[model samples]
Target: MYTLLIVDDESIAVRGMKQGIVWSDLAITEILEAYNVKQAKQLFANHQIDIMICDIEMPGQNGIELLEWTRTHYPDTVSLFLTAHADFTYVQKALQLGSFDYILKPVKHEQLKDITGQAVLQWKKNEEKKTFSVLHKQYVQQWEEQLPHLIERFWQELLGERVLPKSKQIAAKLQQLNIPLTLDDQVLPILISIEMWKEEFNARDEEIMEYALRKTASELMLASWPGTVIQDRNGINLLLIYVKPTDPIIRDEVQKICEEYIRYCNQYFKCSLSCYIGESTKITEIPGMYSDLLVMERNNVSASNKVILANEQLQVRPFFDSSATSFPVMDWIMLFELGRKEELLEQMTESCTYMEQKSGFCKEDLESMHTSILFLLFSVFHKKGLSVYEAFPSKQLIDSTINIRTLEQFRTWMYKVISQGIGHFMLHAKEESEIVIKTKKYISEHIHQEFSREDIASYVFLNPSYLSRLFKKETGISLTDYILKERMNEAKRLLVQTEMKISQIAESLGYMNLSHFITMFKKVNGATPMNFRKKIQ
Candidate 1:
């Protein structure tokens, strides 16, 4: 409801408005009458006045002075000026002082009524927003002061250090504060966190970033959960979502919304976004589930900004075989160095295909893959005497990190980076050859050491998927298959030339179990270890 304050020294004009205008029809709840500026200020101080309709000429304090004071102090209050004088100077001053409108003394009741109604409607909107903010602030404070203790108890019960009764007690206290939850009821919360772009933004900017993210999250929560999204708090905006039959669908909707929002931020705001979805459990279980989500997201820095459900699959697996497949890592390096952007983009389709295949990777694996690729690219850039920042820059780094949120984003970023400076990038292709050679050397030596495909990764420090693909591209053999073949040949040599027992040879070759050794040997050589030994002899 909007409250209007009418200030006029002329009694006749004030009576005319009160009698001629339908205040109720205009939706003005309280029509406060003030004879002078002092009385109007007193009313403003005491009550919530949305609009002030005052006479420009008044005793002691004039409407101009009153409007100026309201402009500074009661900025939320819309000011409307009234005066018998049709002075252009007064009209100009009123306009300059931020008055909503200035009406001459012989005010037309119809015009005055219509303008007041419009002002009232606008004021109501502003008032509602103000009311919500006040409520949000009050509750946010309550949650902040109490959440730490509640979370501590929640953890204790989750870890079995405390009992259910304690958890119930904490839930009861939250209910007392009108948060409205019980130990029996489940609470599903989406965990939102920001990954700073290497501290480039200052404190104020970071605060603004958090605020923007919170607003976006809040809007998404409203869209997805409607009334169930009670309140949000801190930099980590936890939306108190109600778990229902359509929850998975609801969560998916929320995830889609957040992904778009995060993409916008990356494209327009340049902030790194990461989100973790927690399971729907009893409200008391939120802390435990959230802790797990945080740990999962922390251990995996390359996750997307989408809301992840608690029980959702999250692992680091090979989503793309860079050796068997093609990615634009090389093309991008070449383009970035040579500045052949047009040609680089022309080669982007293949690279995008590889990144799109990364959808099969769990959130954790996707993030790890992102990290590994960045490190490798940085290394490649540094080896070629190019600055990592100069070639890729911080913004690109953030985009690449956030790009894994979706296959499309990944592809988009890959294309954008690949199409940078193609001709200039060819120079860095020198390291590609060296990286391939180093990878083979490491594998040849470490083949006898039970070297898994991933273990061969330390040689070039690329991701296992990337190295696996790179080796096959260069040597036409998978790293693991190559390692297995080498190990079998070494075993056959030991079996024939050295009087080494099968068990001894197995232990020497980093196999702990004799049966396991025989299985692997037969799998590779098409014969049992003993048979191979006899045949070799």
Candidate 2:
């Protein structure tokens, strides 16, 4: 008899699985249920579970996380994942975590029984290895199968600086993982960077494709040398070839292998990538070589689908400037204000495209472009009276700009900030003519004060051009005309009702020069201020 555990967030589904499955047929007499990963972990702690059928999607912790834990703590327990998520990431993680089977849910009763019976059979097979020789054989077989992954992990840890990089520590780890290498051994490292993806893929798909690429590189490039391709903590792929630095033909072989590899990847993996090769160095010194190759990749913006060596003409130079330095940051403000959306975006795209295609453009170029666009957009937003936070909306969208990795990503973020900021300005620029009414009200309040259009604009918190354009567009009158009309009408009010002279009326209406005020009043009200007062009387 075998014990089994069913883990699903839906208690009803767990109940159904417990009641529907005939455990006796599969020699599984006991069954347990857990609502989530935490509860399932609790069940595992108490029981000697031989089989576990867990759902992949749960609230607190996912089935993959539980499976990872189970594999570490209870490797003998055969685990199967039952999940609605057919996501490639989940499937990949499940397999990597040593899950016995991945059964998609809404699985038929017969299918469940068949799968569960197979799981039981596998568990029983493990349980049957009771003799010391049989146990030893099983362990040896498992170790052999796991040796590659272990070695890869060791390399990752060593280069990632997670483990001690001393010679003794390194030699001990190499021996433990059965990797045939020593401190004196030299290894040439090459950095592979995915410049472009011809096909679209999610994060997990990209990871799997990277894995496939590494395996392919191992097959093609490391056939003659004793080496392997391992990924660093930063997700950078490095091909470590164990050979002497004095090997004369190694550089040529690296170039040939990289050329063929790039062609194969471009055709098969649907990606355009470049390989940056570094010189041979000691195993511990591989990290330094990897860092140098990374510098080459980061600095190269135009070169892709080719092999580059450390001593090449296009080498990593000192801190320097890009080809496109003088980007027109000032012109973007005018384009935005004029609502030239398509023209501005086209120009920006052309600039970034040039950077992507031209040499000497690097991470610093992308950063400069990003900074210029951000400054221009924010200046436009401030001029148009839109809040920066409201324009961006999501915090992540703005925060993502802090660590831009590629030209494409930089261009994408630029477009998002531009489209959102300029689009918002376009949407709200005309603003229901309320600012026009507000401007008129502020002018009326200070009609007697000697205030220019600048003062009124300051009061209304708008640019003078914005205040002027909006006032004219919405009120069908120029700001000067509107102010003149209001002040003349106020002069007329003082002319008839109050016992003030025409000169006093003009002066009270903020026209210190009475003669000049009369000329302006005559132009607006069809008569001079003094004449208009006599006519009204």
Candidate 3:
């Protein structure tokens, strides 16, 4: 609803206009009447007036002056000038002040209604545009702010909550802006595999390696052509060059560049380096292409060490699929535990090989697959008393900015680590599985004896907290709750079949404090123990 202010110095004009016009029918619900400009100004400040119908020549302040005031302050408020005199200058001045439409004195009812309706439509359109612009900007800003945190959480889950020192990763990510890729744009994703020969190195050394890599990559690309590149720590360098390629024969120009650097660095230091070039992708598809590159790189570990290789045909299209089928990776792990080793290995090897083959996959696609696989892997690993960090042991590789191109690479890299990890952790899982079953047996045999989580933990040789989490994950209920349910069920049975008293039943279930046992029984069953017995009887 909009408020329309009527301003006129003449008393008769104001009365006739107010009474004669049906403001409500015109879609102007609220009306404020002012005899002069001063009261109109006060009304304008206090309320949101959509349209001002004011007399041109007033006693104190004219309509022209009022329009000027509105123009300066309340610009959104539409102004319609009313003039008695047929002065050309006054008409021109009203238009110059941006009056919606001016009406001469003794205005026709038809003209007034038509103009008001037009002004209302214009006002609504402007408001809608304003709303849409605000919403769009807000949505973009929220994603911009939240994207990094979400990415970090994803990597954390992928690596199984392994805390890697993040300064290098943070610096690399900060350097890489989210550049949009178009089909026409020539963006190159270079996956550089970096390794340290020396075991002892501090944060300073890591920073130096990052700086050397970025500087070297930048200098080489800039010297070759006029281009700008942002190097992320992931060891994946993205170069966006506008230069037209001079050599038509240069089949692997990007690979050549990476190989030259790798060879140069290897000669200078004991540290080995390898670089892989993913297929050239349009800007919009870079993220998905980057992921495929990572997968491809992981698979490359199985191949003989090459400083750099250009896999021009390493496309990311194969990895882009629905996540619905991906969730079975956990179910695969459980199947592995059930001695379906052949099926488990086949699935793991196949999936890893696929990722290894497509290291040039875009970051968006890579992260999606990465999240799906990591969650599945973690579900089983966490259940079996191992964290993701311990299972993968490739935080450096997984967290790197370098694009993985192929499933073969991921297969080669992950298979060994995961298989060895299984060997190390499987025995512990068996032990825990044994303890869990034993604990259940102990509880059933000695339900009349006092038991605490600490006692169970001690018997199982596991941490109390870890055991609690494991019990909940495995059984979908807490240890204490399961025990209580069992005891309560036994008490109910005894009450109906053996004619046991409520106090005796409580004692039989290992509760020395009869009142406490009765309270627990009431809480679980929503009735007193005696009442439960009576009802059952």
Candidate 4:
């Protein structure tokens, strides 16, 4: 329901408008009448007037003056002017006073009703916008309260590769999140690896202790510095320290802080920790440095509760040299090819134990061993007339092999890949035989239709690349070449057996363009389609 006010000096005009016009259809429940601006002001002060229809030439205070007052006091109230005169000056004055609309006197009832209806809609829209503004402010306040947690989540995504490492993108995000450091700043990465807890703890207790550890690290290690501490996906705590360019003593200060943190953890928390401090680099290089620290932590085989700098780890040769007797690569490959699963796994375990005992393996040795093992597997699979890609379709064999960083990761990846390969080889061998049979049947059935490797693979429910590899492995020819061979064979048969024209035969083989078909036939048969048909006939 809405209240409407009519201000005019003429009583008859106000009466006719109130009684003659059907106010109920416009949702105006109550109509308030006023003879002058003073009476209109009193009515407006008493009631919540949604719309005001005032005569422009009222006595004493005019409609323009009333509209001006309402514009300041009741800004949400929509106002319109009704005048008996078509004076351009009055319309100009009314419009300048912020009147919603102006209507000349001797008004039509329909036109007046239409203008009032629009005014009512405008009022409702204004109210709705006000409500939305309030809610929007409330929501923005809530987001501001959670800004810190959101910033931490963004950092976690940055380290986890969910966010790309572009400097401009990272800098813009930092500014938007109001982070104190910039990409141009030098940052040191500190990786804290928790070895063991002296006492037993439940999951909830462990979470609380981890939070306490982060707070302690920030308080002690970064008390005089600016830094951020985040727990990564591996549950390892890392601190990114920001330092001034002229601060030459910052490293020594940070080292002493880390030592104190280690001592405090062992004493109060009953947990042993090994700290891996990375070299200071720019913000964009932090991800690489973080990866290096992860590798160092995984490769640590020394005593716990110590600080290990990345440079020191790089200088020392902890694992055996590659020239030493590592693992029997050929023997392992032979066992794998022979399908001796138990013996193969045992041999792998024994080799890993021996490498751990020797304990001086470097990055190059790990990569070399990875390459050797992959080469051995590829050879065994090749000898068995199977492609590794066809045997294991889901695994990215090349990329995963290249990304092997530590000896432990290499060992785990090798064991998993070999084990999965052995299982898939047996299954895929039979599957590929069935696929080849089905593929041949499909090709022969659809020989007259335009189809591709994707269509054939879709029919057999296999990936196109995988199916192509399987077809080539079994048929000694690529899928495209084989399709062309089948099409040419059919063309020859049609030319020799049927009395169809060369164009008709080409169209029957799904070649919409006759020239393309002739070109292909010439390339394959060393003659045009008509030439081949005439020679055969």
Candidate 5:
């Protein structure tokens, strides 16, 4: 509903318009008439006029002057100029005065209806934009308020392997959450391993003290640089300092912080702990690096309030591997989970060959190797959420760890254990493979449609973000990267096998912009579509 004001020198002309046009059909509920600019100003002051249809030429004052005044005083009200003469000056000045439209004397009622209909649509759009602006501001404020919790949640997911930990994925998520870090950037991690509390405290009280220690570490250790103090699921507090990969002297400063941090914790918190600093590594490699630091911590059973630097010495060691990094426990766990059985066996055989060449390898060393292989089996089963009975149906398999008296026995035991473990993994992996196979099938069917992760997630009955994590965990590649690969593969096939134009192919593949399609094609295929076609021909 809107109000209208019609101003003209001729009362007959105004009356004629009032009678000719159906104001009710134009969404105008009330219409007012004014003979001159003064009367129009009075009407504008007293009434809520949404639109004004005014004649240009008047006896005392004209529509141009009235529109100029309306532009300053009531800017929301729109105007249209009406005149008998088609003078260039009238049209130019009418436009300069910000009138919605300039019309010659005789106008069709249907044309007027169309123009006013467009005007109402534009008005509604403008109102919607204003409302959107307010809503956008409100959302920004809420996101800022929740940013801390969001960052904490991101770290927890990343540590738990519930989020894809690739550079592009991490950077996009960080950008979406407005975090000030990139995954390509390197971070130096200091593992704060609390050995034992000197004073007795309940689990809840200890958790509170640990929280206080994390805050203290943030205030003291990270005061000089930008960093975060994160506590993992196991209640392991780690202070991650964001640094460049080429920044080699961070360890020097790390020593200073750890010395003070250790002293402060011992004196106030009444706990014995050690800070083991790792080399600067990319964000995607944080979990593996943190695991290595855990191995270093677990090996040092005698140290207390110490500042230990973990170099490549502990790189491939597992929690109970001691100093025997002969086999990469985590890497092998990753391989077994991905169902790479032959490669895993070959690697195990290679590790045994290397051990055979060494004269100092003894039963203790064999015990470390045994622990490493057992860790891989346990870790993979845990990740799949399977029971011990389901993983190893025979108690003999668990008890057989003690039968390994010599290198040959250890080798035999490992082969039997790994082969049995993989059998279970492959059976459960079929369930995961079903999901991956279903996802790939869905992507193949909708390659030409623009759909979101949420759309695919809903199809698979999973959460949107969780779908990406699951895909990456199972396939060793991000879901988005897999989709891009499929799209590019289809593009190559079309370019070589079909007679379609590049633009048509791009559009068929749901790429609206031809240049963007070319750029992406070049990025993926190392050649543009035209060049690819040329080579094919």
Candidate 6:
């Protein structure tokens, strides 16, 4: 419903028009009568007039002036002129004032009603347009608010191989996300590894402190450069600095900034962080550079609170001869037993890289590696109170150890077996007491089975209630939580390493209900099984 105002000099003219017109048929709910522009202005000030009909030659202010004022103040209201004269001058002036239509004096009620109906239709269209514009702006604002998160998600997918690494695809996604980056842009990946915290803190506290470190790095280290600091899935902070080819001194500048950031973190946050500066490459190569930096960080076992350049690490080659003397087997055993996997792997890689560079793999080199691995396996199993045969149940351990012919094959086998042995040993070693260790080992060994508190307690030879309390007191996590955590961790490993379907993975984790497994996975990882696989695979 709309309000209509009629203006004229004579009362009878206004009264006749107001009474004669069938306003209700045109959807006009209220009809206001005014003898002059002054009265019409007052009526307009009080009510929201949708349409106005006025006489052209009123005293003081004419219909042309009223139309001009209405057009300026309430442009949405449609105006029509009623006049005794059909003079060209009057009609021209009314049209110039933006009146909707010009009706002759002594107007027929039907003709006036038809014009009002048309005006009402136009008004409704304008209102709809206004509403649509408001809605469009609201949605645009919402998109802008969510743009940062979307960009982060896109980068996560790109880094995780969920999105293809082609330049065209990356550029298209950048445009869609409104990120001011392109395929041609040079991006340097700086891996920030938080080494040690001087203060004791819980998991949530550590997360908050890490977030603060990232924010500080963004503001203090890369303030002059355009970049973003993202925490990868492995909890490693990566700062991608976008540089131009013209900026030749950026690498040195970034190195200095990272050194300064390290000092600041040590001073203020009571934490030591290692910054691995990667070579600047095109945006499309960021994922590769990111992976390289992670490797570099892992190999940085002997250094902390320092800036290590990727170029320098790449340049490090084996300086010793592999055939001259065998590498220290006892040192490798010590590092492995100490759970220094990174240092162990780094030493092995350095030795192999040097050996391969010097004379390739010889019989002596193979014997030396085999001896060291055997020593490591024997010592590791002995400390855990297990024999070599018991440690490896699937195969004859000595037979596999004796069959290594090449350095490449030995290296592959070494990594697989060493990583598994260290992982298993560390899981049991984390429990402070023997009973807790037994409970943890049992949970790990039977992770695929649907076991309860009673089942685990029976396997560990303890009362269920006592075992639960002891496990919590020793490990700071309940037995049930420990089982779930182990299952989720295994699920993650399988998702990344294998091409098994989601349902199969869930079943392997002892989840009979696919939806329940997905819900639980999402609860732990913030992503479903399928999405998590996409992120890692």
Taking the tens digit of each residue's C-alpha lDDT, what string does model 6 give over 55-103? 9998998888888889888888888888898899989988887777889
Which ten residues in a row are the worst by lDDT in model 5?
Answer: 314-323
Error in Å for residue 240 of model 3: 34
lDDT of 4 by residue, 402-491 (tens): 676666787788778788888867665544466677888999999988766656766765434445555767777766667777898999
* Clash number for each model: 19, 0, 73, 7, 0, 0
lDDT scores in order: 0.63, 0.75, 0.62, 0.76, 0.75, 0.75
TM-score of candidate 4 against the unseen true structure: 0.48
Could you estimate the TM-score for every candidate?
0.29, 0.36, 0.41, 0.48, 0.57, 0.60
- Winning candidate number (TM-score): 6
Backbone clash tally (model 6)? 0
Clashing pairs in 5: none
The segments of candidate 4 whose C-alpha lies over 4 angstroms from its true place after superposition are 36-46, 56-69, 83-97, 161-187, 192-206, 212-227, 241-276, 280-285, 295-308, 312-537
**What TM value does model 6 have?**
0.60
Tens-digit lDDT track for model 1 on 1-537? 668888999888788888888888877777889999898888888998888898989889898999998988888998888878789999999998877787876899999988887787777788799999999999999888987556534433443322235665766665654544455556666666554332233334555766676666666555655323222222234555655444433456666766776777677666556666666767555555655554344334234455555666555422222222234354344345556566655555544455557555355645544554564356445334345565567878656665457656665666555544233346555444555667667866765575554445444544343444445565666455566676778888888888888999989888888988898888778999888867766
Candidate 3's clash total is 73
What is the lDDT, from 0 to 100, of the residue 120 in candidate 3? 81
Off by over 4 Å in 6: 84-98, 162-166, 246-249, 314-537
Write down the lDDT that model 1 would get: 0.63
| Candidate 6 positional error at 166, Å | 4.9
Predicted candidate 6, C-alpha RMSD: 16.0
Model 2 clash count equals 0
